[model samples]
Target: MFEPGRLHLEHSPVQPPDVAYELIITYAPASSQDGPSMHFQVTGHIAGQPVDESFDLAADLAFNFASSIDHLARRHGLPATQVVPISLHRQYDEMFADIQHKLGRHCGDPVDARHLGKT
Candidate 1:
């Protein structure tokens, strides 16, 4: 399920029968000396393990969070091809636009090289 600033994913695998988990991601706009960015908090469990992590994404790159979600899912033992299952693309687009508006970011905006892990 997806809401403006949050997304929740749940999975129950049949192979392990006992395997089940949920992942929730919440994000908001933040600013540091480096500039504006998006702060994200991921909380939930994978199978029987608890998961709690946080990270920040440069505003210009925040829309790519789906890729990050895929990474997190894999790290938690989900299949490599598993990703956010958003049945409505329009909802994702709305969330993207909302984040962009909150961060005042637009296409072609300059991205900090440091945030890109270049330096």
Candidate 2:
């Protein structure tokens, strides 16, 4: 399920037998000190292991949050390719727009050069 500032994903692996997990992601604009960034929290469980982590990303890199979630899935023992599916592209677009609006970011705003190298 995808909401304006929240996304919830649940997955159960048939091949792996009893491994099932849920991932909930919430995001919001960061404080002024964070400088045009978004704050994110991922909380849930994977294969009976508790998962609670948070991170912040600059406006230009915020859209890649899904990839971050994929990394977390791998850390919890799920195969790289078998992570939760974010098939609703439309919902993602909505969430992206919402984040940009909250951050007062425009489509053509200049991106941080340092972040470009990281990508």
Candidate 3:
């Protein structure tokens, strides 16, 4: 569900299966001298245990999901709207790197898109 100015992805252990990596993303974008940055906090469960994490929310999502983003943004009447091109695939790659850096678990090779409910 998308609220006033936030986008949310909801899921439960029952939905994600065994490992139970369920996450909710709450983020806002910011324009800085360095570059654009997004602040996001994710709270959920990993293997049925609490997993709390945060990061500079880099824009990431499947191309097919753009309409979802637009829907939310329009619903909220967000201003200064602009379409910024970014590579979701690359962001996903970095996500694993960030996950490893923060979780102390190498999330490469072992994480299959098939297991993630993706083809």
Q: Determine which window of 10 residues in candidate 3 has minimal summed lDDT.
A: 78-87
TM-score for every candidate vs. truth?
A: 0.76, 0.79, 0.36
Q: What does candidate 3's lDDT look like per residue over 1-119, in tens digits?
A: 44433334433333322232344545555443434444555555434556454445222222223333333333332223322111233343444344334333432323333323321
User: Against the hidden true structure, what lDDT does model 1 obtain?
Assistant: 0.73
Error of 1 at 75 (Å): 2.0
Top-scoring candidate (TM-score): 2
Mind giving the per-residue lDDT tens digits that candidate 1 earns over 9-107?
A: 777775643457788888899986676788888899876788898778777778777667667766876654444454344467777777788898887
**lDDT for position 17 in model 2:** 51
Backbone clashes under 3 angstroms, per model: 0, 0, 1
Query: In model 1, how large is the Cα lDDT of residue 25?
Result: 83
A best-first ranking of the candidates according to their lDDT comes to: 2, 1, 3
Worst 10 residues of 1 by lDDT: 80-89
What TM-score does structure 2 among the candidates reach? 0.79
* Candidate closer to the true structure by TM-score (higher is better), 2 or 3: 2
Among all windows of ten consecutive residues in candidate 2, which has the lowest summed lDDT? 81-90
